[model samples]
Target: MTSFKIPSAPRSIQKDNPIKFLLDSETIDCLAHNIALVHPVFDAQAFKRLALTNIAPLGIMDRSAHIAAALKATLPAKFSEAADILLQTLTPPNVHTDRLGLSVFFYLPHTRFIADYGRDAQHNSGEDPFDVAMRAQYELTRRFTAEFSIRPFLTHDFERTLNQLQQWLNDPDPHVRRLCSEGSRPRLPWGARIPQLIADPSPVLPILEALKNDPSLYVRRSVANHLGDIAKDHSTLAFEVCERWLTDADKDLKWVIRHAVRHPAKQGNATALAIRKAAGGR
Candidate 1:
């Protein structure tokens, strides 16, 4: 476990919770090894003792929350310092590697650490904790998606969050760009729904539009799914957006438009089918 590597395949399962093993004793030991490598102050024994305590009854997210709590309890009380330690502990960003599988969940506790503590101003002692939070998430997304961790930030600051996400559309990493769209998704599965986005998805449309033809399908697919979420609530707007993109759509853009309208097309919605036909998704 000194090597601090995640198994390519899950080591075990409890009721098919593939992520359950992330909280296992071995993983905790390895995580401690990795964290201790970079953070001189991290108390490995204390972290392991706390992380493993009362973990058996929990499911995946609960496990993540539990581990995050342990980190906060053991790491520095100063938010900025603790965030830096965790950020420094990250593995290299996993770019250009699709279907990275469950192993990336190795960072699940890292993301949970931010989500649980990202907005703590008292601990920040006058520093804007949000800025550091955003930085941590940016780094986290490249290695392990920050989509779920970002929701608390969106809830805490809608305009600021959207503005930051908007700015990330042009990021060099496809993972970061994909997060711009995926993180704001109205009904992103497993992610807490952003009520503002769900109530009126207009704010997120610009992000989708910007990434509609992203060079990485990893990013384009997120844009399409975000569009599909918009369609679930704002069908007309989604349809209009798809139609506009189709005006001179290249194959990539066409693929995006087609994916966005797939459900409606399946149900024989005329406009959806027409758009699908134009995109040549058949």
Candidate 2:
């Protein structure tokens, strides 16, 4: 696994940039260590041995604000370039496989980075003569989908970046196909809570439906999550989706139910609790 190293942003491009203030390796290590203490026996070395980062001990809640701050600070001067570096850096060497916690930490930040960069490129002068926003989105997504299989993080901007990602999704890349599902999730853990998707989720329905029987297991997991998010706000819709999915008796769908319902169930939502009881789910 390669060590992820984003090129350091120079001061000239964006002076007194917040990003420059936040890209501190000492800070990241300190935060990572602090969170790692949550699990007494969690060994950081062994966890990083398998070409990934560990999420069990550190969940997203503790680190999200810090990571978001770091990434946000970077946007003014090096957004486009910094985004490229961050995505490249999040791969195996830079992170562990326990992606749920990791996604919460990085995905939301990444999405915001993309959005901020788009805004910056659109507004900033001397960026590029040829539509920097379009180019930046294109380059960012193109490189991102290649290394990471997480779509939920990448596709939070379907309306803005869909044109950029559509070709890749339609391409031979299975990763991109997986992304189509992962990126549209409504309640994707630490990822942005897509309010529209949580309420309606219709915008991404076609994408998930197309991926219901995807060849890749990785891709299929996203379909289940997309459906599960719907279950959070619209139980009726989730029930319908589960009804269809249960016909196939997929263990993965069960996993989605358990994960997606955990929060609502804990909150004592009557509908979720009833569904859990009826399904004999704990």
Per-residue lDDT tens digits for candidate 2, residues 196-273, read 666577666667666766666666767766676787678777666654554554565555555555556788877667
Candidate 2 yields a Cα-based lDDT of: 0.48
Best by lDDT: 1
lDDT of 1 by residue, 1-282 (tens): 344455354534447555676667876877787788887668999999999999998988899899989988988888889899888777788956475766788788889989888886887776779999999999999998999999988987889988999889899899999999989998999888888888888887788878887899989999999999888888899999999999989999998999999998898889899999999977
Candidate 1 structure, TM-score to reference: 0.92
* Clash number for each model: 0, 11
| Regions of model 2 farther than 4 Å from truth | 1-24, 27-112, 120-158, 162-178, 246-282
lDDT of each: 0.86, 0.48
TM-score of each: 0.92, 0.49
Worst 10 residues of 2 by lDDT: 94-103
Residue 179 in candidate 1, Cα distance off native in Å:
0.8
